[model samples]
Target: MRRFLYAENGAVSVYLILIIVPIFLFQAVLIDFARIKAAEKESESAVQAASRSVMSSFDSDLQKRGLYGMVLSQENSEQLFSEVFAKNLSSGVTANAFHFIDTKAVDGGMRVTPVYALASHAIFEGQLLEDMKLKGPIEFSLEIADKFQKSGVKAPFQMGSQFAKNAAEVEKLIEQREDALDEAWHSTEVMYARITTFHLYYQKRISDLDAMANRIGLHTIDELRIEINQVKDQLQSLSNAIHNMDLSMSSMMTASPQSIQAALSARSNLEQQYSTLSQKLNDLEALVQLIIQYTALIVSTKLEVAVNERDILQLQQSIEPVLRLAKQKNDDIRAKLTAIGGSSTSTTSDSQGVNDVFQHVSLIGDNYFYDYQISVASIASLFTAFHLKIESIALYTAANTNQANAANDAYWTLVNDFYSKKSSIEKARMDANDGTKAKKQTERNKIQAVLDKAKQAIGGCSFIQSQSNDEALYNKLQGDTSNLESANVQGFYQKYRQVNAQDVLIGNDVAYDLDKAESTSLRAMDILGVITQASEMLRDELYVNEYALTKFNYRTYGLEKDRSGQAKLSNELVDPGSHQLANQEAEYLLYGFSSCAANISSAYAEMFSLRLAIRTVENLLDPEKELLNVGSPLLVLLVAAAQGAVEAFADMNALVKGESVELSSKLSAAILKLTYKDYLRLFLMLHSDNTKLMARMQALIELETGKDLTQAAAYIQTNATSEIRLWFIPQMMKLFNGSDLLGCKVVGTQCQFNRTAIVAY
Candidate 1:
């Protein structure tokens, strides 16, 4: 060996052998170390994967068991852990030696220690094993162990306790009451509005009726003044004539020298007086005849307030009570409810972003309860005013002179009376035809024909003359009378019947003069013949007089009933059918008015109560602002519930918007648009805690990449250490204001990474 070491030529060979052997041994060590290191790395990766896989299942397990009822058995846990650990094993590695060395529980999770047995590869078995340990057949055994930790964060929920149970019941009650309130309030308001509108209409109609009646009254006054003036003029003229006549008569009584002189003066005065008296007499008789004829044409009609007072009164009676009931209910609710919680500021700046999907913004305006209250009040006031207006309308009687009281036959009665006279004439003619004759004139068929026609032409002139002869009755006649008989009773039936003044009955253009001998009588006959024409003139004047009494025998179409159950003449004043206030609308107004007050009162009470109760429930949901941050099951459920509610809001918004796409009415669109979140937010506000709710929160924290995700992510760098980018831990911490996740212990804000090393010699 010394010679070899010194010899250069042989030394080279020996040096080569020595260097190669050592080099080979070093190579073996390096190869075995590489293989072992590779295996160790694989094992570590597998452990990490198993841990995460198991931890991620926490939620699923909690779901299956129920959030409140968590029964995590150790046996079941071990089975899960084993199954996961085996699934993550590297190829060629068996778990025959794999066993649980220890198990422990940690905050938010479970800790498991599992040891793994593995075989060395043939590449590192033979010489590498001998060098490390003297082993035959190279039955080299290796065991790898690691401490795996799995965790799950849990939220607290109190679904069955006093706070939850009672609050839930109260919440249900509040919902029911709110629904009732909405119905009642809206109903009452509708009634109030209808009644008010109808009452306004009623007022206008009644005003028109009043005006019409007042016009009639004015016309009657004018007519009465005209009659009084005519009578007064006649009286003045008569008095003057009588005074002058008396003076002349006195002068004639005393005959002397002074008497002779007085007689001459009296004679002149007597001539003037005679002429004046004659003129006055003619004028007075004509005036009296005219008055009597005017009386015959007069008629009296009853006028009254023609309102649907029965229907109107029903509304009037109903409104006050309903309003009172509504007010009472409001008061009662206010009394029952205590103080509610105040609102808290929100952290979210883009809260309205949630509403972008919806088309309508209903909760902001008239759709809200506060506005509904205003609506109710406004309608109530209008109805009250209308009710008063109805009450203020006067129910009175007025004279409608145009309406007839009895058989208002102007010409028919005359014709009938003429027929009666014809019967007597027929008998007279028969007597004259057989053998008799008038005292001087001969009665013939041609004369009879003329008499019959003249009789018709004369009409009721004789009767009219008799009525005209009633001088006192003529002076007493009013503007319009119900009966002509009563008006001219003193003068009626006092005329000379069967007068021989044929000239008076004959036509003015007649060729023959029947009474040329009686010129004075002939003049009277001419005047009497003119009576029919005058009577016709009077009847025509009165017929068109709007205020003149007319035959009101027919029922007034739609006027109010009088005390005698007769329809008043106001039907002419206003159209009853056109005014539809007294129909169904009127009845509904009554029902609503009657019930509105009570309904609204009850609604108000319940609404107020519900408001207070909602506030209380909100308080219970979060007693303090901090409760929202607490890592309890209850809080988790609350967030879950909120999340669900928000999601539902989005869904509802989508649904309504979709349905209302073709709608024309913007108001309907607004009304139909709604979201549960709007109400839910309100519900949350009344919370005593006054904490702002965080939206879309999750609970999970990942401690490693392989265990947290499907694969380990690594960034390429130059001469840089591998940076352990912990992506899951942060993600979990951000899930909520909590530090635990997947039943894993979060030590001082992080999950504790449990690692273990196994050694066997």
Candidate 2:
């Protein structure tokens, strides 16, 4: 060994050979390791990228589903998985496949099942596996086989196995995602159903309320109308009675002496009758006032009640609890309906059917209930008041009738008395006239005196009776006459005269007595006139009272009518409230539907993301493993070693042989310092110098001379003091004059730099 070592012939060459060979081997190993590491890193990065893409896809799907506000469905989950698969597979990774299985096993068998699959073109029998996987016999197995076989490759390079494992994991994730999606969809369905039910209930209630209100209103108006008619009839009757009294007065004034006393007695009775009639009329007026007050009270109360009912209905319909429940039901229904393919047409039809049925029932019941109540109350109150008013009126009528009867009796009594008195006086006067001349004169004087006394007594009695009648009539007629010349008044006088007065007496003394009687009759006629006036006044007062009562009745009627209107309005509002409820229900249903859609979308996205992640891991693990198997480790390592050595040598050489580096730095600094006018010259010089230096440095750095100077230069540079100490030189130049070095040139021993100066001025 010593001889061999001591041998000088090829010792240097041999030593050089030994050292170089070992160094080469070491470099080869490093390069081989680096290449393997790089491949592995690349694969990992691709897998990670794919996983991230999958996650993003899932997240996007979830967002589309509006998972926060709604629910998810199965369809959404499937679509999302498919999309993720497409995106992930498109990446450089190997073939990817997606599958799902029910977590709940049937008959104790595996519930897991293959749902979807994707494979690379390089992979053979891809369809066979895909089809087999769907057959349900292949129990939850995920396999990713590369086009190249795993055999005949280096150790620790089972790419296919790794990919298969990754596939399995991905499939598992997809299954989990699918399960989540199902749960979300179920929840959405439940919520939808609740909301729908709530809406329907609200509408039904509103409809019922509306019907009741309308019926009440109609009843109120009818009652008012009836009252108004009754008042009008009463008024007409009073008017007719006044007209007849006027004629009775006119006839009394034209009677003869014999009738005068009878007329006076009749006048006295008539005056008494007038007083009674007036009192009866007053009583009727009082009764009417009482009815009016009561009617007003009832009307006001009914109106208030109607208003209250409307408010109560509104409150019931708008309650939050009701709304919430309805919304929930709506959501539930929507979900179920969607699942069952219940389109909008079917739902709308069903809803309409429910509404029609409920409306028919509710409206009938409500109408009946309200109408019955209103009708009963109105009829009872109105009839009772009417009965009372009529009874009072009838009593007044009876009293007036009695008074009239008394007046008739008195009139006839006075006529009989007047006839009797006239017969006696006439006999006495004849007897006196037949006596002696002295006796005849005395008897004539006595007869004349008796005649004068009789006339005076008749006159006084008629005057007193007429005056009394006139006073009574005046009291009755105080405020009744409208024009005192109506057709009613004229007709009244004609009828009374035809019924009560015509003829009484005729003679000289009789004519004189007739004239006196006529005067008394005129007075009595005037008294009758007063009585007629009183009757007219009473009639007018009754009419006025009737008018007042009618107005009160009308006002009461109006109140009732208004109450009915309000009730109707309240009912009308119920329909709107029902509609509002329906609308709310619809909104709830829509919300449910949206939630379901959102959940579906979210599920899809999650599935897609899981599939994508699986595919990414599979691709990275599979293809890279194949590549590693195919390539020879030793040879790959040798090549990498050579390249690294060459690069290191080149970098060292470039640093050592680089000429004008210091000069270039100086030129750069000079260029930086240049003013705008000098920048062009410096830029041109630097440009040329930089170009030449770069070319030379490039060749040296490449180590074409086969030297190692890179390490030495790196060490020196690392340890060396910084010659270019102004770290802010560029900034300073930019600040002062805005100049940057563009190029550098070497000329003999000097270097020129070119710079471009940005000048504001």
Candidate 3:
């Protein structure tokens, strides 16, 4: 004991043990805390990931099918959540994996919340938490909800050669659509013309028949009897002639040879004269028979093929214009019979955050952002150090492109569905009354039944003459009142009215759905506009870059006047590397621009349609000039009807195939430099000549809206000159029309109009 109390060497060891023991205890507590936190984070992340997966799937299903088949159903909820959870979460702290309990429906979608217990064994002086009587595991409940209103994009345009192939295919599809529409337009015009001709022919025949009827008094016995009596009176007057003829007969028997021959000739002349009088009566009878023939033909063809016309001519004068102006539609039966005419052949978005958003540039866009020196090599060596940056931009642009494509799909799908439904409805409506005979048949059956009963009760109604007016109708109605009362005739008609009201509701739903789908597409225009504008900016950038390279070459080689205004080298010589580098930079920039342009054009057309081009072309035309029924002067209307078919076919190839036989883009690019003024002039001229924009302009010069194409062109020139211009900054073009001026920039450039692009598609 005395030695231990004096042991000073062991004192340092005791203090070291106390310090090391506390440090280890603290370290163990921290490790336990970290493990628990990690488990919690894993649970939360799993919930989020599962929710996102469901939402994406829901949207995909919504687009592919309708709402009914979406995976949001209860049957799929658990399986879907489990799949995502497996991918996103791990059981590092716990022995058990997370499982989905249930999914609850939210406002637009469903909520997926999963619960799991995290088993974390703690170290407390080398003993497990279970042995220590502490909690063995912590339960974690995680919830995530999907938002459907936030529409996401899916279909993205591919890069490189894939883009070109896709664009060609879409272009071919558009051409097929245009050709079909135009062919129908021509056929419709011809059909209308034929109908009109038939109407006129029958109308003239009616006029001739009317004159004959009036002269002969058809449908009247008194006139024919009166004519017969007049002929008898003429016969009575000719009695003296008859007696003379009898005396001639006796003379013929006893006369000399010359006298007898003369008497015989006179007798023959009298016989011929009598025969001519008999022929007049037969002619009047034939005229009456012809009137009956016209009436019978009208009945047989069921008022379709009318003679001295009613049905065909009547429709031609009134509804012909309505039929003419309908948007070109597919007539499967007729189109199919047209020998199934020819077939189909085919043939990104830009990221704004990429630090450049130049819609266009002349000298330089004010918005252009390039590092002056510090990171200048970044853009220069785009393929190397900046490859990831380019890839990122491509990805982001692709997402926006997908959004744009998705937005328009719903609209076009709705439109196609609407038309298909409308066609079906029309067929149903046409058969609503079963050729207008069902009502007549019903009324006839009622009348016949009543007449039978009347005959049984009292007798007499053997004659059945056609009623002339309302008196017969009133009498029949009075007679059938008892039957009508028993049958609830008024109530039966009221049921039809109720049915009609239901149809009206259906109509309202159709219109609302169509408008909603279109609005949805329009909402994404801003996003797509960014992508489109970015694509456009690429072209300008390429031009400027190539232009700059040439200027650099000029200065390096000591040109007399270089645009860059740099001091020329003393010797007219430049290094081979510098020259080669400049050429490479220019070419690469061009390659980039062309690829982006092609991809943007393809995606726009693929997601939506190029039929928009057709609509835009049709819109520019005037109503009166295009439609046969609406022309001002009657003479113009007549002349228009005669040439309606020709007019319909005039600009069809241009509208569909995009320009004339030559590609509009190449031609417009080659020799077509359109200033704003020239653009306006060409637009007016093309639209007026090709469509009906200024059909009556020659006569209506006083109206602001209606003036000669020349005047409109001049005014536009004057205005452009007066305004302060943004020369380098190309303003957004007016879609399909304006894009046409840009030519090859757009997928469908209509060169047929021989006009510049008036708008972007």
- Score each candidate by Cα lDDT: 0.29, 0.27, 0.28
Report the C-alpha lDDT of model 3 over 621-722, residue by residue, as the tens digit: 222332222111112212212222122223322222122221112112232211111112222221122101111111111111121122111000000000
TM-score of each: 0.18, 0.13, 0.19
- The candidate maximizing lDDT is 1
Give me the overall lDDT of model 2: 0.27
Residue 560 lDDT (model 2): 23
lDDT per residue (tens digit) for residues 378-480 in model 1: 4444434433433343331233211111111221233234334534643553353232113112322323333233334222213121233222322221111
On residues 1-761, what C-alpha lDDT tens digit does candidate 2 reach at each position? 99886778977888899999888766754443333333333333333332233233322221221111111123342344334322332121333322111011011110111122111111112222332333422221110011011221111112222222322332233333333333332332232233234324323432333333333333344454455455446545544544444455567687676776765566566556555655655544544454454345345433543443344333323332333443344344334334323222333221222112111110012342244234323322332333233223212233533443343233234334433553464345334323212332332343333334433322221211123333222212121134476533322112212222321111001011212211221221122112112212222222222211111111011112232344212121112222211111111111111122222222222222222222222223222232233222211122222222223222222222211111111111231111111111111121222212221221121222222111111000000000011112233222322323312222232112221111100
Put the candidates in TM-score order, highest first: 3, 1, 2
State residue 347's C-alpha deviation in candidate 1, in Å.
28
User: Candidate 1, TM-score vs. the true structure?
Assistant: 0.18
Note the clash tally of each candidate: 51, 69, 19
